[model samples]
Target: MNEKSGSLIDSLERQGVSRRTFMKYCATLASLMALPPAVGRAFAEALAKATRPSVIWLSFQECTGCTESLTRSHTPTLESLIFDSISLDYHHTLQAAAGTAAEAAREAAMKLNWGKYLLVVDGSVPMKDGGVYSTIAGVSNHDMLMDTVKGAAAVVAVGTCAAFGGLPKAQPNPTGAVAISDLVKDKPVVNVSGCPPIPVVMTGVLAHFLAFGSLPELDKLGRPLAFYGETIHDRCYRRPFYDQGKFAKTFDDEGARQGWCLFELGCKGPVTYNSCATVKWNDGTSFPIESGHGCLGCSEPDFWDAGGFYRALSLPANPLHVAATAVEVGAVVGVGVALANRAGKSAAKAGHETATLADLEK
Candidate 1:
């Protein structure tokens, strides 16, 4: 069956997923999202009984890098998440069906799961000349987006293009490109913005939705608070060098070899909010700054149009103080969680029922 409406556990079991593996996957998702350990079991239980979610992924003016990044995730591989947990009925990049067959699959999925399927979009919608700049099966990207979203339970704008109008929306603005949010005014959207957003973060959003039947808490920009709460500078490995006003003047400078801050070289870490610093990439190997490169701030809205690359941004009047406050923000979340835990313990004799940020680290 292309789309399963049966118990999810049975579906997973048929796909060779063990009960223990499913439970562990749920636990990992809980930890990844900074939820209590108990929540993992709850998630497992809920997801087991839940119907496998039908997903319809639309690709417009995109490089397909977002799908590539998602496939490279190691721990929770793309196969385990997409094939086992959800029915990915349509994704031009990954699906074998083509042309008419592909469009038919999408329409069938939408018809079967109307007002229930999760819509995942990964490109900017060009409204220029009535969206003639981009099309899928001769249907304008704008029209397709408008039509598909009407039945989506929730929409996930997976890359900066879909979330913030990425490179397509860059200066000159020839395409009249706009984000999915611009047209998806009625449905709740979860934006995961990056040139290619972190894979774990992408899956985490899907996991949250599957387990809870709702979207996770979002920042003002519609990004998940759990992953996009802190600025890259706050969690960056080279942040200490930034605090000391130490930076690499040029690519070959001693500071560069010493792994000093790259802010002077147009690192947008200080202003960009993402998990690149903390989660790293390629299975936690390293991020851009670790490899002696500056952050391009690909995660932020209008990053491409902000200014040219390799040019230092106008420094904040008290940049160090601001960075210091950013670091303190995590400590505050931990402290608040601790205080709440104490009160809960005192009131109900339940010891450490909630997972604090510190606890989640474990």
Candidate 2:
């Protein structure tokens, strides 16, 4: 049955997926990866006849949000089906096997598909005291990762925890947690990082690998450049507002109601890089900014320590220092403006008065 199920086309047909739908999914993945339209056709052809690679998912210190993000909101969709179609030999959260049987299954799959299987890990591995903080089947996560990565074709760190130590590695970290890269030096490790990474981004990486037999081009942080190449602010709907310096001082203010920039409210969109603004969430309904909340910078490393969410990044940490600096700048600018403007002041005032949302509609 496993051999018969190797063909993705046969499996999809059995699941009642039409060829048209499959092709559409391929096109979507191609676009997500920033590949040309021709590559979409190539992706379809490659995935249709290719044999599914064995995948072993290892979970350590995490909230299970990464799995939830990928599975929820899409019912029998192509993305979910593609994930299901993969030869997932072992996953602690989703696997039916437990105890000795589960461990045996993992071992069998590793040995059978050695040097060709994919190793996916979520959550950080606690390295303190022989990794006592997290263990599976009496084996430390550290040991398991080391053993598994050696035979795997590639390693994908799925989520901020696995990629960058996330919350578990936050200040005063008790577990002495570290990311997967800290341990795996030989293997090519792709970091799909977010508090819970975008579901499509996760699958897009998989699709690219399936079609090309290698991982996509990555950024310096080991993130797929297709998704993490641009700052969220660069693609945000409120980008015009940001350019015009029209900012919302408070959540309930008129500027906010008008959908002005949330920078003053500590939006991390400018500094944070992710596909949130473009791809969005909940079936493209909205993202956090569209839902009237400033970006929490969930995708960036050390976001938890980036300071208070409500405090603007431009402001100094010390209130007195910020006040004094603001006053000084204001006085200097005011004097300069007075000295430079006479008849120009009237023209500037007129221009300012005429400025409206229409001026920055784009």
Candidate 3:
């Protein structure tokens, strides 16, 4: 390990992080990685003793939302503290140097770390016109990426841009944008696919890598299963209203006022996989659905192109819906029949059961 990498771990210790806090971080990391409890202690020991790994963060054709999201993690101050555990050798957005000095720093770090460093990339790479659309220090983003990721220990493609090309690769995709996975085939790439993935998710992945020296288990889409295992609908609070067939027809309807289901208003929660419904945003204060808006399905690939935001998807044929409808109809019909039966019983009890009008006159 290099001096810079060694210093990073030392710095973390100096930052008032006690042995217990380090262990707690490890337990959290293990949970995030879906590892057993035994692994947590091992992770803690490894993180405390091992030298920090070098990390090179690259930016391509992107809006920098991923970086923004990463810096905003408030809990444990994980996002900011991550730098204490890794040698952040190169990040154009965060580095202090500029111009030739910055470029030189990147080259030195890459050369020194060699195959030991981790590479994190945000944004898609444009393949059109010989990749001229985006460049860093006169070097095309494509060449820079290829050169940096050559011997990386692992590559984390942050955000949907780097994972699945994001909106740049959306319909008509004029730039011929391609994801990091499309280019770096040899190295293991973990896709954290969201418009800008949750900050905790980003740091959790890094912590897992640092502790275990390997990528966490991924789902079929190469996403961390711990965070992306269930669809948003399955975890949404409005699911009960959906079951009861109470839906909001418009933004200002009575059902909307009652906080009913937003399925009729085009919620894509049924097919959208993310932790938003559970983890939520802004310190768990609220998610979209809880705020009376339908799910926008931001985590799913090509969510922007999925169709209109207010267009409802056809409900799947299920027995539950049929059963609920039957129960409702039965209650209404039963009330009507009870009223008729009560009227007949009242007349008979008044001595009108056997007497006609002619008998009354006689």
* Model 3 score (lDDT): 0.75
lDDT (tens digit, per residue) of candidate 3 on 254-311: 9999999876566777777778887777765788999988877766677677655664
User: Which one wins by TM-score: 1 or 3?
Assistant: 1
For model 1, state the Cα shift of residue 288 in Å.
1.1
Worst 10 residues of 2 by lDDT: 353-362
lDDT of 2 at 300: 77
The parts of candidate 2 lying over 4 Å away from their true place are 1-5, 317-362
The clash count for each model shown is 0, 0, 0
lDDT of each: 0.79, 0.81, 0.75
Q: How far does residue 352 in candidate 1 sit from its true spot (Å)?
A: 64
Residues 24-58, candidate 2: write the lDDT tens digits: 88888789789889978988898887778799999
What TM-score does candidate 3 get on C-alpha atoms?
Answer: 0.80
- Give the lowest summed-lDDT range of ten residues in model 3: 315-324
Q: Looking at candidate 1, what is the lDDT of residue 34?
A: 76
Model 2 accuracy (lDDT, Cα) = 0.81
Question: TM-score of each candidate?
Answer: 0.82, 0.86, 0.80
By descending lDDT, how would the candidates be arranged? 2, 1, 3
Q: What is the lDDT of residue 28 in candidate 2?
A: 84
* Candidate 1 weakest lDDT stretch, 10 residues: 314-323
